[model samples]
Every structure is written in structure tokens, then in C-alpha cells.
Target: MRVVHLLRKYNPAEWGGTETAIQRLFEGLRQHRVTSVTYAPSIGSSIAADPLTEAGFAVKRFRACVPVWGISTERKRQLIAVGGNLMSFDLIARLLREPNVALMHTHTLGRLGGIALTSARLRRIPSVVTIHGGFLDLPESMTNNFRNAHRGGLEWGKLFGALLRSRRLLKDADAVVTCNRKEAALLKEKQTCKRIVVQPHGVPTSLYRKDHRESAREAFPSIRDQRLLLAVGRIDPVKNQRWLVEQASGIFRRHPDAMLGLAGACTDEAYGESLKRKIDELGLRQRVFLTGGLPPGDPRLIGLFQSAEVIVLPSVSETFGLVILEAWAAGTTVISSRTSGALDLIQHGENGLLFDLGAPETLHQAVDCALLHPELKSRLAATGGRVASAEYDVTVLAGRMKYLYDQLIAEKNALRNSAG
Candidate 1:
């Protein structure tokens, strides 16, 4: 089967979980002899492109302009929101003309949705969309800001109309995929789509396996004698890193030997600087280490997971926390906020620990529990690793996605034949 994976960006170096997820899916599909292609917005006129030769997939990039204001991280997001619509509509229309193109799978609901809707309607092709974020379900605090920005740009009505049309596209698609059960439930409750499938994200088990801790420690000697507490994700407001910093300050009062490593790139520069200020204010300058983004195959990342005593994901809202699986695959116990998508993966006291997002004491206590009890940590890590390998492995996830694609293709063909 030949499929087109559509998104706003495809730069793996700058991408977060969504890009990784797409890359994994493409690799998996290639293993099954399925052809895949990716489309992304180009940064400028000088489009420097590269193909995933290993996975046998091609990437097509187009140029678009972006604004510079508000949070630095959000600037890129805002540009994609503008560029994806223009590019997707044109790109999808052209791609649909190719007879071998069986299906178009789109991720996220921003500009990609508009393009998917346009392509599907014009060409009568089968399409699918995956919701990776809750942009449409923005919190009350951010709703006004989001709306005002759209209105200021004279895009509020057009974007809303496009969203309504996109919903129709989702409703009529062969299937709509989500990263977790919670997202699927939300779609159903809010009538976002008629067909929704719960397919969680997966991790590459081999890279994040258990037999790498000693080697990992050798690579990063900074935490050699300390109790390492690790958190990986873009440093953004929604991630609630400030909360973690505050809680860590209190945790240090009891366990001075403990250290928290914040990994991944800072999504918002000002916000990241603000977090640094908080660390300084609480006198946690020494205990907290902020390691900026790691390279694609950085052993330091896997090392941090393997060496850390516990991995924490404190996101206030997450569709699915892939880092939790990565930590588990590395044989590290996890402590996540109760409200996150990791809640589906973690079974408190069984696989890992869960804490209330609202209560700093709950997080502090969970971290303390992991520190004081080696036996519990070992059990959680061992059990969690096994579960992660079995359920959330990239190979397994790829197989499931391949099966879904095959089914969608067969159904599309059958419908086309029946109509003829």
C-alpha cells in the first residue's frame, strides 16, 4: 500500500513526539513493504531537503512565511497553522492525482485538517486524521487569547469554518485515530468524529532497553553519586516544569542527595528563563540541571533514562506521554501526574507511581518513596519494562498501524468498485 503522511513539520532534529511517532510509523510500514511519503512546510525559499533512505520514504517541503511575536516556541506553531493550510490544500490536491496514492493519513487538526478535507472532497479519496494535541479543546485561560489572535489576523471565521469542514471530513473518513483512550473518549463525547480508534504511541525498545545503565552512567558522570530524577519533554507552560521545580525545592529539604535533570529543548525561551529564575530563587541551582535538547541518537538521553532512579512527566494536559514508555523501556520507574495521558500506562503501586497534579506534596512523597525503597523501585522498573516492551514497542505499534492502513485501503477499493 502507498500512503502519504501529512504534517506541518518533518524536521526530526526539531520535532517532538509527533514527528517521532510519524517516523516510527513510516519505518514500520516500510518493513511491511508499504510505500510511504511525507509532506512538510519549508522554512524558506532555499529548501534543504533530505530523504529517509533507510526507511524508503521521501519528504517534500514547501516554503512559507511565519510571524515573530508572543512566545518564541509558539511562533513556529503559529506559522505552521498558517502555512499548513495553504500547503496541504495544494499538495494534497496534486498528490491525489497520482493513481498509486491509496490513502492520506494526517496528524493534528490545525492546517493539516483543512488540506485533508479539501483533498478528500475534491478527489474522493479515503483519508484519516489523528488528534495529537488539544488545541481545539483549549483551556478557558488560553481560549480568549487564541480567539483574539485569530480575530486580529482576520482568520477567526475562516479557521472556524475550516474546522467545521474538517469535522465533516473526519466523520466521513474510513477511521480517525487517537493516541489514547482519553482522547478517543473526548472525541466521542464532544462528537468530534464518528469513527475513533485508540492507538497509543510507542517507543523503540532496543534503544531504551535495560542492559545499558552502567554504560549510561559512564557517559554522564554528573549524577554518578546522586539520586537522579529525570524529566524529558519540551520546556513549556503546559508541561508544568515550574511546578516540578517548586516541588523539587521542597524535596531537597529532606533529600539533599537528590538531583533533577530537565531534558529536551526549551519550547519557550522566556518561559525557560523564567524557570531558571525560579530555580535560582529556591536555591536549587546546584540540584537542578537543565540539559537542552539531545541529538536524535543521543546516548545521553537513553543514558539519563537508564541511570535515573525515577522519570517524571508533569504535563498538565497530554494526549499520551511517550517519555513514560521510554523510561519504562529503559527499566526506570516512573512518577507522573494523575491528570496526564500516562495515567493509562501507569498502574500506581504496580508498574509505576502516580501523583495528584494539584498537590506538590503528592509528587514529593512519590519521589521520596522511590528513593527510600530500592526493592519497590526494582520491582516497578522490572515490571514496567516488561509491560512497555510487550505493549508499547515501536514494532508492535507499527504492525497495528499497518493493519489499519490495509483495512482502510481494502475498504476504499471495495467502495470504489461497488460505485463503478
Candidate 2:
């Protein structure tokens, strides 16, 4: 079967959890004789390699724009960078002309997702929407940011949104997939979709089981004998890197040899600048290392995961924490904020440590526990690794998704035959 995957934004330079999830999902889908064609917004020609193309999937780029006027060029770019509701007439036209597509799967929402769903409906095929980020489960702070982002401008695209029924993406899709169980439950309550699948993001466990500590130590000489506290995610307000930087002084004081490493691209440049200023102001310039965006499965990135004493995630609102699973597969202990994803994965002192976002002291205590107690750290990593290997492997999750795809396709064909 051939599936067309739609994305809001996809740049290798700005790789994140969503991109990695799709790449890994496609990896498993291949075994089920499923072929994929990915559609994304056009990118700059300066990019050297396309990871999706390298993974042997066909990638097509379409012209997309923010459809809002009176916003500065910089503002427009920022809006697009942080999940703007972009409109793409080219994508709709392309999907209409595309040949022999079995199903349309959208990794995004808003106008793009509506386009995919509408096109699929017209073609008499099924549509699937995967909620990579939380929609109904977003924190108030995040929702406010999104609401206030493109204010004082005319959103001329409302007409297009209305015509496409953009707001009804979940309602229109045959199946809605979410990585968090909480999100799935909320969607089930609110949406009238045929199915709501709670599909946890998966990792290739074998890629992380190697001894890559030496590679990490060689690349980051300062962390040679230091206890590494690593955080992996894009540098954004949502990721809460600023909060982590604010809490660093106490951690440094507690463990003098500890060094904090942040690995990912800077999606929000303003937030990135603020984080750097805070790091400098707090005299953590020498202590905190900002390793700009590393592509998934990079040896150095995997090495950092393997070498870390504990992986720290301080996200403000995470639907599913893919980084936690990667850390688990790497056999590293995890200390995470109590987001929905962390709550689903970690069992307090059993598999990993969970701290409250409102309580900074709890985070400090969790880090201290992981660092000060060797036996607890080993037990946590071992247990988490076992869970990742046994349950959250990409192949297993892919099989579940393939089964859902087959069911939806069969239902659509039956309905079409009856209509005929």
C-alpha cells in the first residue's frame, strides 16, 4: 500500500521529535510492504542532505505561506517556525493529481491537515491524522503564546480555513492517532472520529545499546571526567530550557563536576537568545554547552545519550516524551517534569524520576537522588531500558499502525462498493 504523509514543516537543520517519529515509523512500515510519499513545505537549497530521502522515501515540497498580512518578514518567519497555520494551494492541487494513493496521513493540523482530509474524502480514500503535539491537552501558557503570536495582523486565510473546514480535522479524519494516552482519551471524548489510537512513539533499541561513551568524551573534552546532565529537544519556550538554566546553579553547586549539555536546534530564536543571556548572567557560560541541532541517530548524539549520568526533560507541555524512550534505550537514567508523557512512562522511583513543573526543589532532589545513589540509577535505567525494548520498539508500534491502516482502507472500500 502507498500512503502519502503530510507535514507542516520539515527541515533537517531544525529536526525535532516529530521528524524523528515519522522517520522511525516509515522504517517499520517498510517491512509491511507499505510505501510512503512525504509532502512538506519547500526549504532553502542550502540544505546538504534530506534525511527522508536518505532513508529511501520519496519527498515532495510544495509552496506554502502564512496567509497573514501586515506582519514583518521576521515575524512571518517566526510564525512559520513555530507552527503557523500555513496555506498551500499547491499541496491540494498536487494531492488531487497524485496517482494510486491508498491513504492520506497527515502529521500536522490546521489548513494543511484539512487539505489532506478533504482531498482524501474526494478521492474516496481514508485519511489519518496524527497529533504529534498536544492540541486539547496544551498548557494555558502555551495556548496563550499561540493565541497572541500573530495578533495585530489580518488573517486573510480564514476564508480558506472555512472552505476547507480546517477546524474539523479531527472530526473529519477516519482515525486520529496520538502518542499520549491522555490525549487519546480527551480526543475520544471530544471527537467523532471512527477511531482514536493511543500510539506511543518508539525507538530503535539496538542503535542505543552500544558503548559510545568514548566517542562522547572525545568530542566533548570538558565533560571527560564530569557527570553529564543532558537535555534533548528543540530550544523553545515549550521545551523549558530557560527553566533548566535557571535551576542550574543549584545543580552545579551540588555536583561541582556536573556539566549540562543541551542538544537540538533553536526553533525560537528569541527564546534561544533569552536562554543564552540567562546562562551568561548566571556565570554558567563555561558550564552549560549548547550543541546546536544534531540529526537523529548521529553517533555523537547517541554517544551523549549513552554517556549521560541522567537525561533531564523540563518541557512545559509534552504530549509524549520521545527523548525519554531514547534515553531508556540508551540505558541512561531519566529525570523528567511531570508532563502527560512522563506520567505515562515513568513510575516515580521504579523506571524513572518525575518532578513537578511548579516545584524546582523537587527537580533538584530527583537529580540528587540519581547522582548520589548509584544503585538507584542503575535500577532505573535497567528497568526503563527493558520496558523500551520489550514494548516501545518501533517495529511493534508500526505493526499496530499498519493494522489500523488496513482496517480503515477495507472499510472505505466497502462503503464505496455499496455506494456504487
The C-alpha TM-scores of every prediction are 0.87, 0.98
> What tens-digit string does per-residue lDDT give for candidate 1 at 143-255?
55544553334333355435537546566666888887766776688665646788888778887753656655776667889989998887777778988998886787788
Worst 10 residues of 1 by lDDT: 81-90
Count of clashes in candidate 1: 1
Candidate 1: lDDT of 272? 85
Worst 10 residues of 2 by lDDT: 43-52
> What's model 2's TM-score?
0.98
Identify the leading candidate in terms of lDDT. 2
Report residue 143 deviation for candidate 1 (angstroms): 5.3
lDDT of 2 by residue, 68-167 (tens): 9889888888878877999998889899899999999999999999999999999989999999989889898888888887798999998999999999
